[model samples]
Target: MRAIMGLDPVGAITRSVEAFLVALLMVFAVACEQAKLPNLLLISLDTVRADHCSAYGYGRSTTPVLEALSAEGIVCDAAYSVSPITAPSHATLFTGLMPQTHGLRVNGERLSDFGLTLAERLTAAGYQTAGVAGSFVLNRTFGLDRGFEFWDDYFPAEGSKHPSSEWMGHEVPAGFDRRADQTTEIAADFLRDSRDPDRPFFLFVHYFEPHGPYVPPDRWRKDFPCDQGSSELESMVSAYDAGLAFTDDEVGRLLKVLDEMGSTEDTIVIVTADHGEGLMTHGAMAHGQHLYDEAVRIPLMFRWPNRLAEGRKLAPAVSLADLAPTILELLGINEGAQEMDGRSFAPWLLSPSVEGVTFPVFMFRGKVRRAVVEKRWIEGERFGVLDGQWKFLTSESEEDELFDLEADPKERMNLASSYPQEVERLELLLNPWVRMKSPTDGSGITLSLEERQILEALGYGF
Candidate 1:
């Protein structure tokens, strides 16, 4: 068995309302001769699509750094986000709880510090915790700042500038990367200096570069084409890709420091996106508005030197929410999961499992549509369960839509009128899951007039 050191920031074990299983963890003293495990680093990129990364088969050269990292890592080709919006989706990711159960259904809502976050769980288990996040959406005010020893989440142009009655909500900061680069510097310092040698650390470094405003570093602007199309959706994707390249360079910088610190050998580093971006595949201008793959399927890569097989792709249905408990299990902080909705993939990372054990993944976008995903199918209310080969959807606002995913991965067909029974079965399966979502609750904190206007600028209450 692998021996673990004492829990630093970790507290008493957590309980899970869903899994109903308590993982027992014991601190072990490692012999000086044994390899010292590297600390854990969980890096989440804001709005990257899996299909846009070179490692995941994008024709563009968008992820050279990540592609190199993937050689020694585990990749989940079919990973999905449970919710499209930042707060709810991230809530699911941190607590391992369903958004419905966590009670944060809107962009404005924050997580309850009383809840166990991946940070809290790791912190209680004796690991030092730190967070260097890049967006206001993931701020301390929202309670996502619970367990960190040092949480430096300075929002971009919006850091201290709230909305004024005169401004239109808020303005996108002109040079977001210049700001995000500072976050990298902060995280690197935590990894190299703040870390206590006797204890390990769980650091969450999130970058918001690829999110919106479609701006990129000047050097990489032409990487993707402005001519992919004249549509806003296509241009947005081009912008996002450029942002991804810049973000990847930052990842490389962090990796270089990990190597210098001699922590690369044992560290468990992961790179993934919160959710995918929409390129008008379904006639949608932006994301967070559809449950289509364009909005939910994002890239997931886990790099743990020699602990995982290189170039291996797990085809199961996985969610970003599962990351919390899984990391806790590895760190020996085996308590406090009384309400986790995620399943650990640690065992699966070390070895493959038999088929019968599969998990269901659900995704939602507002109240518009929800999906039930299994190993071989992504079913919507209109066409029921669709194999990767076929896609289906229907609603009163529109009729029904069906397309051969194998042929129309872009989703451009309507076969609902021809498949009523399938649609009914899918609707039956989808309705119950939809009911589980918590109704939207605005952020609980009362904001100043400027804050309210800022919210309006960022696609919130108009």
Candidate 2:
């Protein structure tokens, strides 16, 4: 009877049930995959320049750990910070917005409460978020600790004394900053014993090393010993490199903790710098005074084994502002990216070919104090745009300057006069950005006296 009808009702029903079961299984598999969130470890190395890192081709082995990680990760060869100042650059890093939009223009300036940080978004998505800051500049009072469940910014009280050997004979004020090793120890403890092992976590570790008052441990100083006749700048540079190496060792220790936890392969490890030090580049002793490449270009690297391409180097110019959006995209989070000023570079990471990929990197430098101006560190506020090979810099108080970065990477020669049309084109791109009003208002926050003193110690006083 079933053969006569060419289909039996019982068999047809069974086939349909099997098909539904297969569809349900596929859906469940996808759901399980989506539920598995990878842990995130974000390490910010304060004041380390890209060109000074061994991974970026610096002659010295300043960052052997970074070089080893780069071997199994993707390196962004031309990453820049939107602002050269610590607070502003970190604000951009967390918010995926430019300093102008985030409303943290300089050090000591608070990040607006209105903006959503990367940590906040990740927390909402069910990830455990924690942060350990190396400097008082990122204290909770400054508003960078909004989304973190546990924020560690504890420094000793003022007037606390430390042995001269620890600080390399410099009188470092207590409650100002902590060393990279200390920060790494805190971060490793959180990774090992504090966080919920079952739940994915977002860990942020900041290392304030190689900044000003270059102080390296005795061993590192010996490793980078300066000649007896070395100039002051040379001595400073040697100390700076030693500090970098010390920070790198701490980074290695942090990574070792992750490996011991058996989460190294499953975690997304990102290493970058808040901004670069001046090191007398362009006649500036430290950062926050110029828009030169040495001050703005940062080291950005992403390491995710088996998930991302390995040992690849991207040549396109990317901003620190792009970090938040890129991380969210990589983790399959799509809710709050529309409001960011930075575009995601996730596609470039996934795509095999990155040819002809270029984007404009905008930078801003607010006016320094009159005292700094009198010293001629920098004159007034400066704005710069780097698009393709041409970099255009303009200031209200200084002359307009342009450079073909490919031809003159040092930016010694100004071609603003020769390339009027290029400057005009870049101006069209920069003017509207400069004029855009910030959505978040941080002007209401006033710095406390202690905070002001800390800023002064960090070389950021009005």
Candidate 3:
């Protein structure tokens, strides 16, 4: 028994064995942490409104598929988008910041890529990432393509010109099945081709249907009539419902694919919308003009079998910003990746109680705005702070309005006259919202002479 020191061979062996055991324990702990990360799938519907879905209690059967998904998970009732526009709203969802903070204020503008997106954080954590966006607004030109390993932003050929069609309530171009079809195809391929050793994927598929022109397949068209069954406007609503029906079926197809692949139990599926379409709510035909309830409210649902309880509804004034952090939390990713503005709703998913936590979801729109609901009020130009019913809106005009959401859900009456003191309190919170918006002097990428002429003919890019 030769030992370097005056020790027997057995004592040396014993020390070595103890050291080896300690090393093995450390490796096991690291592997356990890495294995905890869950796969994520985020789905964004272009124009489906929250009120139009059965999960949100709409009169029409616009979302049977979405209803099924919600029945298996949690549905958010008081969900609202941070902005009304498509690009800015989506940016807010990914970055967990307001449109003003991210700088994707309008359709043509874009957020800078210096900050980490939800996809980027997942990618850093060793997850594969993909984005298949339906609208040109989601194109890389707008920077929504950052952080994704593969981004297929292909619009219909004719739709290349109609960036504002969301306002007109129309899908891109006369014939652009490529938007929805290609997104599905590419996303599915990404799922199939991804290798096993890599962490699972964070796939985002955005659909551009039921947005405008409300055209549905022949089978779905006849199901609903205009006006509960009366006006062209009502008929248009019917058509919108039909389009939603088609989208729901597509969602079902995706879910079925997941089930077939044995991925349903392992994936965290999220479904939400950029904003809702107005069937003439507050005298508005579509989104992008006013911050009426129709344009601000959106549907948000999440499902993850064995991860979250089923058949639950959460109320905490949730916004699109909360989606990113909530998903990250559920995925068990704690790389301290980046600071996100939204907090994780993971606690509520496992347990329905958000009672003590008090963070009002604040939404902003237009140059100046007003408040909705009682005691809680908001005020700002491009920014708002909701203090628990009187709301104030900031602009050059600096106007304030108060509503009792409990008493006046429709917001038909303004009670600023009775509650003068509450208005002042909300004004203090509104200051930061306005101050956070960085002013931009940058213009859209200039067009060449020929391109300018073409854009003018197509009613775009002027």
lDDT of each: 0.67, 0.84, 0.70
Give candidate 3's error at residue 152 in angstroms.
Answer: 0.8
Two-way lDDT contest, 1 vs 3, winner = 3
Question: How close is each model in CA RMSD to the real structure?
Answer: 13.4, 8.0, 9.9
Measured by TM-score, how close is model 3 to the native structure?
Answer: 0.80
Better of 1 and 3 by TM-score: 3
| 93 Cα displacement, candidate 2 (Å) | 0.6
Best model number under TM-score: 2
Give the number of colliding residue pairs in candidate 1.
Answer: 32
| Model 3 lDDT tens row, 1-462 | 356557788877899999999999999999986686667889999876787888788887878888889999988877878777688889888888666556777676667864579888888888888888876667776789889998877565653324444432333433233445555666777777753534787889898877776667678887875545467787887888887887787878777778877788888899999988767766556776545567777899989887688888887667787777777777777743236556677777777665445455566674424544233343444444443443444454434566666677666786777877766656545544554434342443344565445423422221
> TM-scores, in order shown?
0.75, 0.87, 0.80
> Under the 3 Å rule for N, CA and C atoms, how many clashes does model 3 have?
19
Candidate 1 on 1-462: residue-level lDDT in tens?
122565533333332422233222212234432434347888888877788888888888888998888877888877888766677777887888766557876566667643577777676667788888777677666777777788876544443223222221333332223344666888899887888888877788888777776677677777777874488666777777888888888888988989999888768898888877776665554566666777778888888876778888887757776777667666545585435666776677778764235554555544434432222222232212233344444443434555555655665555567767656645544444343433334434344565445434422231
In what order do the candidates fall by TM-score, top score first? 2, 3, 1
